[model samples]
Target: MPSQGKLYVVGIGPGCEEMLTLRARKVLESSDYVIGHRTYLNFVRHLVRGSIVESGMGREVERVKMAVELASGGHVVSLVSGGDPSVYGLASLVAELVYRNGLELDYEIVPGISALNSASPLFGSAISGDHAVISLSDLLTPWQVIERRLRKALEGDFVIAIYNPSSRRRAGNLRRAMEIVIEYRGDCFVGVAKNVCREGEQVLVMRASEVAESGVVDMHTLLIIPSTESIVDGNWIITPRGYSRKYELEVE
Candidate 1:
């Protein structure tokens, strides 16, 4: 065993064991201490031979600090996050704390499939074109900033994938987002993928107007609002990547 310990910020990939990358699994197996949110830890608990540390939401800083301290003490640590760590995950937190404190530590970020990746296929090729992923949760980001981003992305006609569309505390945020959607692209195809790769997975493709009217969404839901040029065809949301526009196509 090495004398020095290292930190690995691992993404477990949307709560599915199969979605866990090989590097992520190796890092988890090699860890002396595995720390992460309780729900994310449960997904890879089977592969973790080390001691597991569980924390609930809003304790991200505490978890990263504990992992750092453990690593500094010569213990290899794996800080787990659901989905790709770079995308709204714990990797940035680890980096900020380490750099800000000027701590001498070795760390690596192992990427994994994000919720956007896992949820994309449920809507066919909805994300095949230019797309924007925005989280509707205004906990860290201001709602005004979110609205501005939504407006700009929709104006540019980028397919928009919304994360954290709603929560018990912020149930109206998704409605607010839909209002913006209506303003830019009215009654467009909207795909909702809930629970993603986890159990109780549900997928729905509906008109933007319908989604706005029903207001059926939650924190677990990912809403894919396709560009105005896209359309719903035979239960699939297809966003063309400009191929038909360039080439002469014939029906076979």
Candidate 2:
């Protein structure tokens, strides 16, 4: 029996080549096959020296199965994902498939800069403290569950980072999210980071009440809804991580 080749689950980051990790780049360049969603594949097409297998958004299972088949045949494979693979990416799916099938596959997961990592800097310490990352897309998960999570996170005063907030078909989701946020926090600051590190990048800090009317959010947008303790200082939204209450510091 031929030895099974290694499968590398590589995170390509937010479409910024410089933000791509060295390990991820090396995996893409050295692998005999590179497989991923078409959008993510375009992000690192320049680095892939191997045969490319690109599929559409809803074809994740197909992509992973193809990658696994190639790797099982002694071909090194790199499965690319946007943002950190473990965070709402393909790493979990691949692991599930391998475990459920009882396949002994040699695999590794490479982390990369996620949207929150790339977008938070634009908000200037908006999520410096304890936070909750939630996805608004109800494709796989029910909306009621997502709403309950949002309410609980808000009630606990946790800063929240919302991903996949809205899209063409799910336009009302973000608006409803903003409503829930406003109910708990009473019109708090909501940071909208659109197309982070990509073309037409935009960062805006607006009130949660206004988010419903602003019409700025989309699928590419990541929201940073600060805790009640957070304050808007000049051009930045700063979340107080209890540093001042714990220690006395002289300000110049």
lDDT of each: 0.86, 0.88
RMSD of 2: 1.4
Tens-digit per-residue lDDT, 63-134, candidate 2: 899989899889999999899998899999999999999998999999989998888888778888689999
| Model 1 backbone overlap count | 0
Regions of model 1 farther than 4 Å from truth: 212-216, 248-252
lDDT of 1 by residue, 168-187 (tens): 78877777888789887776
TM-score of 2: 0.95
Count of backbone clashes, every candidate in sequence: 0, 0
TM-score of structure candidate 1: 0.94
TM-score against truth, every candidate: 0.94, 0.95
Error of 2 at 194 (Å): 0.8
